[model samples]
Target: MILRSQRPLKLKAAFICDISLETFVSIIKTAYSYFTLLLYIAN
Candidate 1:
């Protein structure tokens, strides 16, 4: 939920970093999943 909400910021960050969309998307997905997993574990 939070991750979905962060998409705009994430895309901005990715652009600022000059990362290709394909690569940036993969990275974002990986990080988002990691964060959600962490949250699940915490709860």
Candidate 2:
């Protein structure tokens, strides 16, 4: 009975984790691009 109640919470957690992972990747990509652009300008 306890496991049944927790099932939805587990799914919600997994969904949130997936979203955070995607956001993290996108942030890193944006930062990387900005860094490269700065380097090019410095040259």
Best by TM-score: 2
- The lDDT, on a scale of 0 to 1, for candidate 2 is 0.69
Backbone clashes, each candidate:
0, 0
Which residue runs does candidate 2 get wrong by more than 4 Å?
1-19
> What TM-score would each prediction reach against the true structure?
0.55, 0.56
RMSD of each: 10.7, 7.8
Compared with the true structure, what per-residue lDDT tens digits does model 2 show for residues 1-43? 9888665332234455534455666778999999999999999
**Model 1 off-target regions past 4 Å?**
1-18
Candidate 1's residue-wise lDDT over 1-43, tens digit each? 9889766542356356555578778988999999999999999
Model 2: lowest-lDDT 10 consecutive positions: 9-18
Model 2 error, position 15 (Å): 19
